[model samples]
Target: MTLSPVPDRALAELGRTEGGPDTLALLVRDQDTRRLLMLRAVLDAAEGADARVCSADARARVREDWALLAEADRVAPAGGGAAADRGSAFPGDLAADPASASARDTARDTAAGPTANPAATAPPGGPTPDPAAIAAAAGRAPDQATTSAGYIPPHPPLSPARARLLHPLVGPWARRCLRELGAAAGPPTAEGTRELAHDLAHFSALAAVAAARAGISYAVRLPARDGALVLPSLGVLRTAVPGGVPVDVVHRRGRLTLRQSGVADITVRLESGTGAWSAAPAWTPAYALPGLLSGAGPMPLDDLDPYRTARGGPRHHALSGPTTLDDAGRKRWLHSWSAAAAALGLGGEQRVGEAVALLRCLVPLADPPGSAGGGRGGGSCSGTRREAFGAVLSSTPPTPATFAATLVHELQHTKLAALSDMLTLHHAGPQERYFAPWRPDPRPYDGLLQGAYSHLALADFFQRCALTATRPAHRESAWTLHARYQEQVGAVLPTLVGSGDLTARGRRFVDQMVAVHERLEEHPPPRGQAARARAYVAAARALWAGRRIRPTG
Candidate 1:
């Protein structure tokens, strides 16, 4: 069965509550334009919410068209005549039939001298055809792009909104190259102009996909909201995109076309065939639409074989350490990510900041439960220097919550890895192994710090989930989970502080953590759950003590 990341049933569950994802339900009856505006307000309210996932340009464009539609509906011509020409720009009343739309575009390109932007057209309230969807419609599986040797579209054509959103981030460079290349030729040739338009559209699509996958946020500079817009340097872009081929520019007549021979299929169209920008446009914006990548749902783990040793990522020493999952395993893994994203308020921040990509290639462990993989249960890895990140599940997690927590745990590591690169956390301390509550063996001080911080983050996650949980049991369980993590950090925090191995900077960082922990502890977990948390901590320590403390003569 095809798994939906957020099914109607899941939304129904959220709608039962008064807050968080609950707000989405209220938007159901409103027009898509108004729905988008209302949703933006919610995304803006949350601190550190990744609003980049929604395209402001798309929203603005759609809003304008929506206004026009309202006007048309209000003053339908005397005979209830046809509305004004909406064109194929914004999907709504204006959406033309596919064959006719295609014919119009060709005619427009031929007659309009190609200066006009070939706006992506889609049906109202439907998903815009992305490459994957288009390819699927064409009888090719979405994975064909990866498995096949030749270029296949990376993703369906980005929606007009997404295209506009990504333009500012990468557009200037593309425009500059197009201008320079096109300048090489004489002025005003229809054929050349069309090529330039094609190149612009193609390059725009390529850049959009790259930006989405890279997970970098571009804080667009706006009046009254001047923040840093982080653009990827050429060097960074090389590492972030596949094949990393520099976009080759070619001049024809009076226009320039981008040659992406190796990276994408030349013949593929970048517009959605569904005619709708999204099946659930209003909900998607509030939920951070970009976070919902197409074709990312469940697939057999073995299908990832092509990417196991794929070029153009962080170089790993080992190719195969974990076993590949069968169909059942893939379903479980897919469900876990979907459930976690839904349960936790991770939509805005799903791929923001430190996350580059949500890695899914799993290598199962041969050793039997709990005792296998050197006593390590499931472990995840990410390259410290690059944005290559993913998890390695040694075994299926007992619950979706467990899998979700693991994802958060590993993401914390990536955050730290990125932070460590910017600021030195510790001095060159002695290479001495210290206690890590999770593992049986002693870890270095650095390792201990990462573990402790991750647990602290775990505590934070559960704490937040508890705040929004409607069910009494879920809330209590969340509190209990938080307490357990809080207790784990409490045990390890002191050793880290007293180790006398920390640099001044490291000490300050640790101090901040301690302060946060103290404040969090003040809001104690639900009564019985607190005691249960303490007991759980005690039990974990006893297990560790027995395993680590032997006759060390």
Candidate 2:
């Protein structure tokens, strides 16, 4: 049997708790819109918590949602079959158990219920959909776009919200391309316009699915009482959606956009219900529903620690590593970074330090248990809070410098993941060590594109340490080992060249590295060292330059 889905609604609310994921309770009830809003808030909080795993705030939110969910009533489903959307990474493996099943039953019941007379269903309390009810929906799945046939839509019609989710760089273009959608959304007297709006909605749904898979946030930017809205996640908002205005969209320049009408337009709509409406009549201000994105960064090794955290984050397990916490113990462990002579053949005072450093260096950046093929992801941000981080490594020897460096490594990935633009991904992935193309498919990262440049960088760093240090070091085998890594670098050169994500400078660097490789056997630096360090450094420089990017397709 598959493990539970950790329902979207639950994920949404739990993601909001201030303390971290630990507080989230699967049974909590949540209004859909509130959950979406919470999604924004929590993502921000997660980002805010940076490099920290689940925060107390997040856990609190999760607990709250779970409580609400627990209070809700359950119902039976009309169709007993589980809803089929796209095939999941593991089909049904992600569906939640028990409570979610109950919740889905409730949702199906609600959808099948008589459309409550608008007058009868309006609760005196507020406009928010009942949280308990929405939470119940966790068991059911969202409607599918098409059947499980091999049929793919000719054009990926973005979801009604998809166009609005494009990153800032691509937003303007969405407006230009979808500008006509504004006029199309109103009550269409013409059969042609009516059909178009219907079609647009369907397309919007599709776009929404695609955007979701890419992990783009889709919340509309709402106004704040204080003139500034605080968001916990990366997303877009409708700066101008009036209460009654139906959403309109524009998908252009790789972004899907939504806009709102001005107060004047809303007033006119309220006043002129009797009169026929047109674009020219009391037109509303364009809704600038904006969106942004955030990424969790490299997958932590502890993420594989299934039982480590109460929140859906990596947990602290004894297996992760050693835990000596005292200062004396720390001092005793800080010496391994030195050469064989410095370590005095493994028993050196610094050997422990070096091993700790190596673990710090390698494990911090290393691939998560099963994630090796995908290249190293954000291992650095596994802990949602400093306290959480402290707890995970409570037993391990502390190394602040290495810890901080690990943070930097994860941040780069988080920044890339947050861009919300496929094109930028196409650009960034190649330049990063894994050489994964910035495109949607992950296939290119394998083969040789996987580890070349970073290996070059690693070699360069280690080589520099070996050459520059005053301590005695191995002279002969270092070059031999360094030369071998260069061969691995050469194997992936073609993948890098085609990455499409790389800038001209990145391409030039790869080319230069190849050139340097051809002459490496000939250019030994001197009696004490070799040309390996200088050559790899040159190669890495070429890969580093580029303009920030946005999505293209």
Candidate 3:
């Protein structure tokens, strides 16, 4: 799929950290487009894998399921219509009538291109077609070129939950399995092949899960993770036994059931028009952030997925170890969230709305060591990753104001991450070479850029607080913070503009940032606050310089 270039206006607005909701939506859509391309690549590799990697039956099932899903996606109404009525007639049921199924397959294949074999379409219960043929009909070729109009409508838009499943965490796993299957020098051992097969099957099961959640009526076997059947964005069904279980998921007439032999069946009732789920006691519901503002719906808390963090790596926010929130912890977070939402509403509704919209999930982190009951002084830190779009890993903030500031700061990072994906901001270079006023250790250009951009938002946020704050102490604190970040951002923008590493677009982007910093200067901090902020900046730079080690040739 070809990515359309971001318009100049959109880039400028984003550079100002003021893209708001509409521009953010465009960035999100681009990420989804990239995900679709990645999905196609995974499918192509799976189709080309050695036949010995998976059993013939497993291969046939995956292919047939994929074809049926493609057909359903084609016929589903635009904008996802009514939840109960949308894609209600399961494509699997088409197997009963070969003629109808064949016709549907032919239509899908015809739309894909000349590479698709219309005659090789697989009906659910009929003889399975060649895996390659099935792939050709359902998946876009990696080399295929198409305009936006032709590409987007042929496939279904990913739900937020489904998109999370296809994140960067899964990419390496899929690549590893593909490498094992494609090894030509020596065939893998039988045990290794079987393991690879199981791993690859997870992708197919993900497709099945997506279909089930789209209100499609169907019964299919899905592999479980850690003895639990996870329904993305919904809930999990934990079996009594350990290891992965092959669970049968059946969704019919607004009711979904999970069944595994020797385990109690779990049932979930899907709300008629809303697509919300009401599950049995055995099902562990996923945590979802409540809709705190009008027209801003709930977002997943994302604590359940094993892939929530990068595999075998340190947690993103090191100050607080990453862990799932307990019942008490969750209650605390919700209470803080309520206060935070109220604070944000008073701060600026539009800004908070846009920031919240870009956030897909909030992964909770444990409070820092030596902090009692996760007190406010524990020092909260939030982080965003380039590969994990829309996810924010953060420790719970101590105050409503701190929470508001954290959201704005992280939103800046999230926006920049998305922008970097679409456009080249700076060329890669050596690390720990540039000074960042916010950090003790020297940073690379990219880190410096992220810091400068986020600090820009923090300065803007504190400026707003200073103007609106009613309490004298609150106003004074806001002024000091506003002045501090203002000085930091002012110091960094010129360095970025002259870095010699930024692309033309990057230079333009930084110029927009400069404009914002200059505007903030019009209302300078109070005399005492400015003096304190300048002294603080000088001390920080001295400390960083003292810590830096000069290299000897």
Candidate 4:
């Protein structure tokens, strides 16, 4: 599918390791659009699947639901505001010809349009779906036709926000699922094909439920996984019955009722005018981050999505599983986040606001031992995924300052991941590893570049902290960290420039990074602190060399 190009100005600002909310918002909107196209592709592939690849029943169900979703989009109201707030326009013809000239040109045009405000004019992509439909549809019951097996819910449209949320639930899985189904060596074996089709059908059911929740009154035959019906970004509904039971999800007005054959119906109330939910006895709501940053919405503390795994490799380090926190544990996390926001504000209020704006979800990880109470080793360890844009999987840091620094550090990774999606900063080549001062093991070129970019932000964060810290000890600590990261970044910049792995755009990007580093170097740390930083860098290099294995001819 065609993607919007990253304007040179936005690229440069990001290269300097800082793209306030506006630039990051553009990257997010583009990612959202790309995901919409990807989902459309998945549906198209499912529609064309033969009996050998996908069963007729599964294919039929997919086509039905997909058509219903498209109809919902087509009938959505106009003047619904910016796509970022509501969601991108449904790619009605994206699956047919994603790379058409019109699609390519629209990408560029949307970038130039207004996106800074939620109330800004609607983006070009037909009409935007009204998210407020959730409130408007709150008390209405589905007509007989709506509850029938092969009928579409007429009138009420799916909220753009609810529609956008479904992409994260199925987009990444679709990428891999499509690849396996479309393998050049024919599709997988019968058993494998069945599994893929089954998964697609299940995802379709989930999508149906999401669309239904946006005030459309309908009943969906949802399959339960391990006796539970999982709804991404919302909550899970557990039932006593096991196996593939035909559970119907009925939405009337704002109340969602889950009805299973032999089991009692479960119901929950959705807040009016917003996607937020009220507590339900039978459902376990997903954790949400406390809204600590001013003017920023609460981000989901996602621990339930199956596809929340870290992309690339374990070197990025992310925690996995359906991790749920107890009351005390949840309280600790909330407090830490609040303190982290305050600490980050000291460094730069605007930067903190921008980081908060870019963050969509937070995946919690176990904190390291002996790192509590602001210890050195207890700093946050966080990672982001290429497919899961806007989600950060992170461990809680002991101190607010450490947590604040981690936020800045991960923001760089998040920005770079989004930026890389739009532009190719480096060329693909055989694996070449290089020493990254911040990491214990040697890193591949891309990993090294990611490290260098993030560290540049860390250096800037620490420099600001050093200048703004009120206490002398805080000042000293910030200065030490600033000098150390500055040295580490200084060592990596030359390697990146000389690596011969960068594209012209990549070289330009690195040049901007170098410019930022040079300006930071102009204001050197104290003599004693600089010596300590240099010694630390030398020690790290020595350790790496000691562990290096030289290749033999």
Candidate 5:
């Protein structure tokens, strides 16, 4: 692969423009309090022009907004608990516990200085918080509170043992998610960075409402040009913070503070402060993306940042794409797929449902704490099935399209499993193994897995494209697998799609789909089998595009 040949400075600047994600590598070693205070002061200076809050009345309004946010959180379904429910470290039952800081709690309910997000630092016109900004906030975690970016997350990353103990707090299924997420965030590889960033961002978005629920105030800490930590003022000091509030976050002495962002902007006294951003006071409420809600596909990937809130991206490509699927929708994908597993006959059923089930089974492998596949026929022939099948899918949502795609992907796993079963099925005696199950082998995610995934992804995309190119809402049954005919192939998936560092499989998947999209767009949609035949041709060509994604499978 050829380098872009962009100059170093230009590249650095471009990287910064991409939100300076590498800023995470800069660790603040000095724990000195005074330096921290000065840093906080600097952050206060850079506060965006719109960030502002100076009056008690305005603070009160912010409080009301927080209350409404809390109510919304209560009503929001905690994702089918598929994700690990990492509870807030802020103490669930704080009233009776002596750990409760009287001043903190009082500060939580009523403070009259500024809103958690000041007008000066508010997004242009007070739109949702940017995902990049939220990510920078993750490393800016406050000094005393377990919360970050305005929310007391329900859980932190947990190990298997730790996850088990916290299951009651976050629930078993969520525990699995939490443990896996934690590992993903801190994994030893580059993809690990992706997972880590994604998790932090995801929770941070949720934290916006979570902070409101817990009545916690938050301030984002940013690094100054001089290398000091600056806490962006959400508007506490400029306004007269009311007293006797339960949670208080004061940024006066430096260091980002965590208090209820309601009425009083409370600040926690960190022994140190970074820099201070602008000091105005005003913040904005966040909501779902307009495009996604309306059912449009493909918004700029960056547009989803505000919705993400913290750092990183989604679990996989589809999830990470310019599309947004709610937690409930994600969980349903798992549930529906599980139900369809037995119906696929342990091979590609050429249906969306099969793909969905296959993906569900594969997702569990992304984590260690989650049990291995047992519910589906491909996993095993155990007498007692999965300890709790709902343990995984329960947290995911069930979307028809997503379910179909996931089922298709997972069926491949079943194929892998059945092949493994076949190895053992033909054993000459109890001592010999016939077929080698693909389960125990190392994953080829970066290799052949990438190739195969690319092929199928395009195959599916072409199927969709066939309808899309033809714009065929009118023809219901014209839908058919294109892999059956290869003569009219347009291009192979491997050569078509190109990414910076994709594995062979990844490259192929993107390649095949790209070719299909290009082909359908190039050739005007023909009527009947001709149109379907063209799509089939396009898919078959791409199906053979990528090289050995599964290696042997």
Candidate 6:
């Protein structure tokens, strides 16, 4: 009990690192646009040297490169439909909508842009428009469009609702990431800043391509210092942009802003020293759904819409219709767990947040205490995979202590789902489901392990709650819960060890879980409490056994 809390080994692995190999891709949308924001390293050797070049030379080379590309391909004009087909966003830009595209469609076919579609490049009728002819038609001097640094282009106004949704999806990450990129820029700094800006511009163009597919214009407004360099880079990037949406890059006075059609602007500004971050983005159903893709966060009860998107897989249990807890139940559950989260500190509670955000959807299952307090596991359904995660909960947890422990337990299952995505921990084993203390039906090895792993965390949470508890009753409850979970989880561990379902990696992962649990087991409650805990676990196991053993007669 005296040992200070150790960071959950699993969470340390799951935490985000700047530009890690993991997919940081997110689906962003507004009333008129839906685009996938993806992380790509575009600061390759071609642009790397530019960082070392003089500012004037860096600026010139960027402009020249942009001009060539601009000449080769024409930018698509804005305004398209909101709901786009799913496949249009990924792997590459959506093919230009042949229906409404102007004469430029012919030019797109002949253009030399790397991402230009040769299949659709030819314009209708006359040969593809030459750059000079196209330039003349648009009434510009033959040289090309401006790549002027610090130029702020006019943009369509953003809706307040769209702004709220889009900001959370990209703003925070953008500021932090761009700041990091700026800091990494070497001294003389001019060259590096320009290169960094150029990369940002490229990303912005890609964002625009996605927005275009959703039938909207896109623009990324950056801070003054960073935007100065990035603005010039946009000229070059504009040409390279795959033909699709019309996207512009601009640097404004303050935060980083992403402006798309019908959505309010998303602005991200990370201040120095203070560590003050922008207000967390407000949540909306459309905006919130993507969070489920990551499977973590506090999803609003009303936001759970099953029929919204086809991307996600089904949950084993169906989502109940409009599950809104009464105000009393809401206040009680929220207050209890919020306190528990503070007690658990960031490390203990982070897994819960991750689970909420990733699952992004909650179905209120509300089981009474004796029967089952609901279940924890990644999925409950079959068919097309969903970019969502689901968790079922009892209408009211029997006690605050029970509520807190359940939070940790379910999050552990959610965290495991995320880990499963990152690492292949087990091989398929015999489908013969075995008895698990927590579940009514038999479970395969994976289910058994999930239960064991989650309860290990639950046990740890209760154990800590017991130690830090201020009141005698709370202390007693904590110890009792702690013992019960530890006993149940420990019993299941032996089964998991022998299940023979583990791959090499799965074995190692389970070993770590066992190691942590054994360490906690080293500290036991008073003999009376220990006995009660044992009985509690035994009762649950007995319940399951009786149900399973009952004759089919």
Q: Rate the local accuracy (lDDT) of all candidates.
A: 0.38, 0.27, 0.61, 0.61, 0.27, 0.39
- For candidate 3, write residues 178-245 as lDDT tens digits: 55556552675886776666665565555554444444556767777667766654556777676777
| Residue 187 in model 1: lDDT | 53
What's the lDDT of the predicted structure labeled candidate 3?
0.61
RMSD of each: 19.0, 26.8, 13.5, 12.5, 22.3, 22.6
Per residue, candidate 2 scores C-alpha lDDT tens digits across 1-553 of 1122333343222111111122111111111122223333432333333222333543333333222222221111112322123112111221233342232122111211211122111212212211111011111111121221221211122221211222121122222223323333333346434332332232233333232222233422222211211111112222343332344333222233444444332211111000111243323211110000011011112211111233223453312332212333322122111111112111111212222211111111122344321112223222212111111221221222223222222222222222111111124532223432212222334223323433443233233333433323333443444454554455456666676666544344445545544544354435423355345534544443232233589
User: Candidate 6 lDDT, tens digit per residue, 1-553?
Assistant: 1112212343334322001112211111111122123121122222444334334443343333222222212333222222232223222221333321221221222112122222112211222222111011111211121222221222222221122223222332233334435435445466445544444443333232222222222233322221221221011111222332332232222233434335454443322111112343421111111111111122333212222222133335423222334445444444333333233331233433333333323334444324433222222211111223333333444332344444555655645654565566677574756777766677877777777877777677667666665556666766777787788888787877775657676777777777777878787976888998788778887887777675666
Per-residue lDDT, model 5, residue 248, is: 30
Candidate 1 minimal-lDDT segment of 10 residues = 281-290
Cα TM-score of candidate 6: 0.45
lDDT of 1: 0.38
* Model with the higher TM-score, candidate 3 or 4: 4
> For residues 259-370, could you state the per-residue lDDT of candidate 5 as single tens digits?
4435544333221001123332422111111111111111111111222111232233212112233444333333333233222211122332222211211122111123
Off by over 4 Å in 3: 20-22, 50-65, 68-205, 271-281, 317-321, 339-342, 345-350, 374-377, 428-430, 550-553
* Model 1 TM-score on a 0 to 1 scale: 0.42
What's the lDDT for residue 350 in model 2? Answer: 22
- The CA lDDT at 545 in model 2 is 25
Model 5 scores a C-alpha lDDT of 0.27
Q: Candidate 2, overall lDDT?
A: 0.27
- Candidate with top TM-score is 4
Q: In model 1, which regions exceed 4 Å deviation?
A: 1-321, 325-328, 346-387, 390-400, 428-432, 546-553
lDDT of 4 by residue, 431-534 (tens): 64688888888788888899999898888877877776555666677789889999999988888999676999999999999999999987777888889999
Q: Between 1 and 3, whose TM-score is larger? A: 3
Q: Across residues 1-553, which tens digit of lDDT does each residue of candidate 1 receive? A: 1111333443322211111222222222121233233323322322121223223443333233232223222221221233243232233433332332231111111111112111111101223222111011111222232233222112223333332222222222233223423334455466554443333333333332222222211111111001111111111112113432344322122122233334531111111211111222111100011121223322112222212222233333422234445445544444443333333332123311112233323334333433324223344332221222233333444344555565566656644543454345676455646766666666778888887877877776677667656556666767878888888888899988886767666676777677767867777788788788778778877877787667866
* Candidate 5 TM-score over all chains jointly: 0.26
